[model samples]
Target: MGFEELEPIFGELNVERAGEGSVPSRRFLYHVHAADPSHLRIIVTDFHSNAWEAVRSIVQLEDMRDNIGIGGSWLEFIDYVLASIKSQDAKLILEGGLDTVSGAANAKLVAQKSKGMPVISISLTELVGSAASAAITNLSLELFKAFKSIHDLYREEKELSNQLTKALAAEKERNENIQSQLEQYSKGKKLQKISSSDKADASALLNNGLENSPEKQTPRDTALTKVANRVVPVYRRARVRGVTLQDTEDIEDE
Candidate 1:
């Protein structure tokens, strides 16, 4: 890429320093200086091919244009840089443990600081690769696990709701049955009371007839016989309705 075209994308460049720079046993090398206010430095070291072209390939991506070209956050820029390099299949090491450093020449500082921060190191040959793949994979797995856990909880809640509904239905049915039985008991008691009253009236009528009859034994006997025929039939009907003889006698005495 022409220096005029690359300047707008990468900001200022030190051509003299980059051209003269050399890393031991490396044939191709490229270093992209991060724009102001960010401490990120992207260094590509290729032993067999052109590393500068790899940076150019990354610069052409739509993501690079949207993130780096359009003035996005440092985090977004870092992601774009990482993805771009991985697409090139360049073997490199990623270290977030990197502090605010001026140059890529200080490998010692980057290594020492790596121990202090969360770091994932991957590389092919001496050139280290990006840790993006591992980070993305872990995040995706955790999201999936969280989704499954929530789904299970919802299913359990539904089952419990169903059980509670069934229990309530059963309880309602029991209440209705109890109410029906109470009604039947009340009707039976009412019929018993009516039968007892009838038996009492019949006994009272027989007593009145005998008392009103003549004092002579023959007339009193005839009156008693007439009352007995009518009263006995009514008393028998009461008995058929479940009024016991003892119950009828108790009513007559009362």
Candidate 2:
């Protein structure tokens, strides 16, 4: 029941009175202690019980620690803490009978907030010398393990989400680059359209140029013309020689 005795089970413990004061009137005290910020214990007690029955509870507080300011309202803090606790799939161990006012209220609250969480109520007085301590130690360890499982799952989900986001961004960039290249290629490969008027103008220009140019004769025609010129001169010279011979023979006859 002693705070010092439970230190081994819940890490180094710290006790502080609730509310502010220059000599506060309220006797209510709440102990907030933990192994780390992620795992925390909050106990509210009047310190009137002869036995240390603070009903120590643990919760994951690291994620929301920054959001809850030092001067934040009590309701804001309570709402965040309740939300965080309900998210956990851990057990709630009550230290009394369900018929009791506090126990019944807690059970109903659990049912409303977290539907399937298991609740166990035990009488601390029934346990002799060290039974209560042993039970609480075991339960606290189990609760811590459950909280760890949830934390690990959340971390994995965040990492996977980040990777998926990066992949999608890269894919989008790649697709954009490909589209840009395709557009450039299409522009480069485009064939300019030639209008019918332009085509007809080009054809007329070509025909006119051919008509004005000098004509070129074939090789066979040039060869035949050269052969006829040489043969005609030789034939004329032979005819003149024959006539000279005939005139000489007539003179001899006379």
lDDT against the true structure, per candidate, is 0.44, 0.42
lDDT (10s digit) by residue, model 2, range 56-127:
223322223343332455444444444433343322223234332232122111111255422312112222
How many angstroms is residue 214 displaced in model 1 relative to the true structure, after the best TM-score fit?
2.9
Find the candidate with the highest lDDT and give its number. 1
Q: Cα RMSD (Å) between model 2 and the true structure? A: 18.1
TM-score of 2: 0.32
Worst 10 residues of 1 by lDDT: 7-16
Backbone clash pairs for candidate 1 read 92-128, 92-129, 93-128, 93-129
RMSD of 1: 23.9
Mind sharing the TM-score for model 1? Answer: 0.33
Q: Which ranges of candidate 2 are over 4 A from the true structure?
A: 1-129, 191-254
Cα deviation of 166, candidate 1, in Å: 1.2
TM-score of each candidate?
Answer: 0.33, 0.32
Provide the lowest-lDDT 10-residue window in model 2. Answer: 104-113
